[model samples]
Target: MKASKSIVRRTRWPDSAGAPLVTPLQPSVVYASSSPDALDAQYDGTAPGYTYAREGHPNADVLARKIDALEGAEAGLVTGSGMAAVTAVLYGLPGQGDHVLAGNQLYGRSMRMLREELPRMGIATDMADPTDAAAMAAALRPETRLILLEVVSNPTLRVSDIAGIAALARERGILLAVDNTFTTPRGLRPFDHDADIVIHSVTKLLAGHSDATLGYVAARDPEHRKRLYETAVTLGLTPSPFDCWLAERGLQSFELRYDRAEANARALADALADTPGVRRVLYPTRPDHPDHDRAVSLLGDRGGPMVCFEIDGGRAAANALVEAAPDIAFAPTLGDIGTTLSHPASSSHRGLAPETRAALGMTEGVFRVSLGIEDADLLISEFRAAIAAATAG
Candidate 1:
């Protein structure tokens, strides 16, 4: 062969008899086929082979299967980002003239998509409190096709009534899609509560380290799953093989990390509630939390790794606390291995109108903490000092 051809066409290696303990990453955007018939088989889904990474790939498939197994889903699809997964569902499941009912307290971007983006596509959406059955019922229309909600609301940490909402959706012949980003499968499985579809921002707890940005969609029904996959492919929402590989690695220790973080969260919640500057603490494990009973029934004894508290002096106090505590990173994101803080008024829900935020009880005083696998006592001490510093002036 010529120099160029030789460099491009390397000899194929023989397969090893032993299997790798970890799934190897396959980054090939294109695959070779022995014949045109074989290539056609791949394209038509008659054979088990990859034709293009945009449609499907080995690493993405492996991670999807792992997520499927974890969530008890019949089928799964991995996407480039959490918003991609949401977009896929919105576009894939419902059509023009079909309406969607969403929880009032979903992630800010999701709300924006349903309220603003979907309308441009001729799809309609209405927001209702997922915890209030009457509100949900009133919000539903004859054209309602799907219901979307988070298992736990962002920043505020409101535990949703999955079983109730699922039952209502079933009665109305509407599909129920639950974003299980916060609770994760270890804490709560939406399928067990009769959710038709489950979504995850694998960038969070599932990935655990905040290194990879990935999202997943899984369905109990095979047809919905297939539709989501097709939509993802059509939209070019495929994830990188490298990010999928990283997510799989993080998932390996997800349970251990989750347990440690949950423990720390429980401890910190109690300590913060008693602190001087804290007006309220919102954690499902705490009896004072509005959804405490629902959380215990749905998520068991653990309240999850996230905790929210309202500082006495609104944004000023929150800013002071963040500045005083150099130990806790002031990251707008969540689910890192180390403790971090997010200000909802500034980061997640900044786009919403002031009245809308007030309705959700997301006052400027509120600050969200993503508890890490740190010593509970140390976290408590740091938070107490931060609260004192913030309140002192």
Candidate 2:
């Protein structure tokens, strides 16, 4: 009652009882309780409240629950970025001397984490061809505790046999973690195939736009979820409330965006296959793709929201095409509402040795195109013209 005028105005809190049609942003770092007992209950996880944003928050809980529903997961946690999601699972599950078996085909950052970072902590990792069940089995060690995979590997568009790999992991008591970033739940729910853990870069298809930088980790078991949460909090990987709110808005039109992008992807792949100077077009359903049969069996008719192609003249031709396509942004990211192009050699896989990149089929000529909801015909024309421009004398 005796406080200054500024303090009185700043301390005023909204007391409205009406509900909003959308999820509201709760950015408060700390929360208050009616009593010490109530605060203690919240801290002990017995009460339904968040005492700290870094530990947990309303926005993250809402988004995580939505992801759980989408992925058919029992529980989920949201983190700051896609790599953070991977980090939470890796650090949360395995301890020193434990081995991790990862698919040879993976995002560059993920590969780096396994090959470079995990080893620093005394955890060992081995790369195996996930498409070949025999190779994966052979790579497994008695100390192997986790098998990391991507439903559809980034850039290259290789589709893994989720059911087969899940079976292998289950038989061996290994926890299988699949990144569904490339093929969101709309395209494939890894959990349906018995995958123990599901991960997502919510910045991609789930959000349907490039506005949010968030990641998600989901699991069927309560203990796994608890461990992930604890690891994420301990590492300060908590997501921003604003980003979580943004992602929730994006989720409202996720399926719509995904369907349109996938259509564009298929159309673009078909068009590019017939164009000159295009050495090869890599799409999951395409007969030319290495994993064509597996893709068809696993994804049904969905080819996902990406298409890749090889230029005839390596980096020069790739650069020419990028420069010619003024309409399509040449960005180093994916899963946006508008089409974008990324050259892996100079971006994603740039850190790897040249020989290693070649072994993985990520040559200088490869162009990873993320399709959008734009007019398919328009994109086809633009790409053809751009390719012609790149190849022109």
- Cα lDDT tens digits, model 2, 262-286, are 9999999999999998889999999
lDDT of 1 by residue, 286-320 (tens): 89999889888888797899999987787788889
Show model 1 residue runs off by greater than 4 Å.
Answer: 1-5
Q: How does candidate 2 fare on TM-score?
A: 0.97
Clashing pairs in model 1, backbone N/Cα/C closer than 3 A:
none
Query: Candidate 2 deviates by what RMSD?
Result: 1.5
Q: Candidate 2 — which pairs collide?
A: none
- Candidate 2's error at 278, in angstroms? 0.4
RMSD of each: 1.5, 1.5
